[model samples]
Target chain A: MTREILAVALLAGFGLATGSVAAGPAEDLKVYQAYFEQHFPDFTPEDYTRGMYNFSQDKRAQYEAIMEFPPYEMAVEEGQELFATPFANGNSYSNCFENAGIGIAQTYPRFDAERGKVMTLGMAINDCRVQNGEEPLDVVKGPLVYIEAYMSEAARGKAIDITVPDDPRALAAYEEGKRIYFTRRGPRAFACYHCHWEAAGARIRGNELSPARGQAANFPAYRSKWGEMGSIQRRFKGCMEEFGAKPLKPGGEDMANLEYFHRRLSNGIPLNAPNNRF
Target chain B: MPYPMISKNVALAAVFTVMHVVTLPLMAQEGKGASAAATGNGPEAAVEQGKAKAIELCQGCHQFKGADQAGTVGPPLLAMKARFPDPAKLRALIYDAQKASKPYTMMPPFGRNGLVSEQDIEHIIAFLYTL
Candidate 1:
């Protein structure tokens, strides 16, 4: 056989093999974890849950000092009260969630077969309120965030365990989420992949960029810049705005799907929400 | 991967060649009266102005050769004159990298976004040539 023809045959065979096989969630998880482990040998999967603190010792020290008296304590306390308080119909948030809504934050952003959509913890909170004849709280901030903060506190130390079902709908949502993450958009023209994936551990101006791994672990976090608690969706909105794009609606389909994919990246990282940040 | 990438690079180079030809006359015109930094000023003054502009706009994400305290988010600016022999291609990259090169680049569209002017890009390009 001629060298050129043989090379073409080999390439065609390789293409066929790769085209038939798609990477499943397990493969994605393995590769995702491996990438971070290779890039940052010093960090345990658990350390990634702390966000940017994993990149800098100085930042970690400041974070440790801040953690000694976390400002989110009040918000967590209020959330605990809100979670337990009976609705107008005398049924509480407990009735709607498994395990009475305690320590279950890690399993959230789950595919809801009944609802035919991805349901975030914030969405579930609103769903519970709507079901119990109470008005839904603000989806991105305020009381909804407090509840999510409390749930994250309750689920502390539990590893993230997001499951994508065998259903085609669930897989479609996940693929869409993955697309949203890697596709560049807006005037600044950056995908979530640009800053968090490609430039992770690098400095942007004075601020160090956080890794995509374990980013989902600390939500409903207290950012010093915001001077208040914010949910992952709120952070998403802020990031899109920073990209000079119109912010996606919080708890919307796109945001939930993005959260689903993002949370999957932190699959093995333990939940550590209500964390403080600079 | 190598096969397709080689072909893609060749195609990109052809596109850049055309762009360089089309833009050379306009660039020459701008050089005559754009600004003191871009016009008849000596290469030293233009390079100095370009260096200042690079530090102000690009130092946050990219490091220049022989520079300290510059960022590493983007690749270091080294051997620029060799890397981009066609200066118009470099100008196109700084103006709108996505349009000039890869579509998914993290580099912002400094000129298109009004973050930097055409004259500013000229100064920055002059400084980059030195590196």
Candidate 2:
């Protein structure tokens, strides 16, 4: 009897220690659990078994069928043709990048020290156009969407690997981007952090807000409200309007810099574009 | 000669005394005005009056409780205290409410309809601060 009691006590002690470890930091855990309970109550450890995984085959097919009717899919198909088509000078877009690599879509919003700017993948594609002596495609226009979809399709299996360089200028840009996100602006006086970072997972106008982190991985999404396809910058513009602030033009420097900051938040997340979102 | 001189001095003193006495209420009114300007209310009674007016008028739509109403006709005022902590900005929002576009078309203007006086709006803001 004495031996059994001792064993029971030891087991209880072990359980308590394990429970405390699982609890984590109280404040972080509280908000994290609150959001999880509200948005994804059914989510489990099994859901995260893989580092980055697509939906099951059936689910993927369902989403694909939904995308078929949208005009954006047509844009992506057009982009694919354009990628292989030679420019008037006989230089193909595939040859413009180093090593003729097709999977360079994910390493964008990179710091370009020569220009002292954070260059998005869309911007890089247009830059390639200029080098080829063709009129650069407008980044905000529908043509860019096709080009992006085409390039991203080429990078289907490639992992996202954007590096924030250790250069002083690059570091300064990151810090500036972070500041811009946190600083309150407009008549409503709301900062990006107030909604996405701080109040994430909370209900806003009957919608569950996703955390700003791990956001860049999914883009070129089919927004149910928009009833069409949109890229990250388009969503950023919508958020600005919601805050009662004037939105920056799509493909502008500020948008690129902001994307650079947002991408850093999702450092290791895999790129999944043209995904469905509500 | 002595009687006339005494009467003349008495008349002048009487005139001056009457003038000072008549101006005493005006001086008191000025003091009250200064205090009212400093404290934003002429007296404590006015603030009480304003609170009563807010409870009657603004409480219908701006539910002070944090619970989700069946129909969220207007934006919840529970987190508003935190959202608009600044008193001046809060006052501006109430007084110049048209600056914000409503999600629905039916929210009527309280100030424009003369349902709330400027003083009542100030008091309602004060009451919101307490919440």
**lDDT of every predicted structure (CA atoms):** 0.79, 0.56
- Writing each residue's lDDT as its tens digit, candidate 2 over B5-122 gives 1232333224334533654454355443334433333334344544555555544444554223212234556555687665555554565444333211223344544444444455
Candidate 1 residue-wise lDDT at A135: 85
In the range B1-131, model 1's lDDT, one tens digit per residue, is 11112232333335434544655576566453345544335556567767877877788789886455677798889999999886777777888876676555678887787676565676688789998
Pairs in clash, predicted candidate 2: none
Q: Taking the tens digit of each residue's C-alpha lDDT, what string does model 2 give over A21-103?
A: 44222332243335434544554432211212222445446555765675456656887787778889999777767645377
How far residue A37's Cα lies from its native spot in candidate 2, in Å, is 14
**lDDT (tens digit, per residue) of candidate 1 on A3-41:** 233222223233443346587667767766776776678
In candidate 1, the residue pairs with backbone N, CA or C atoms under 3 Å apart (3 or more residues apart, or in different chains) clash, namely none
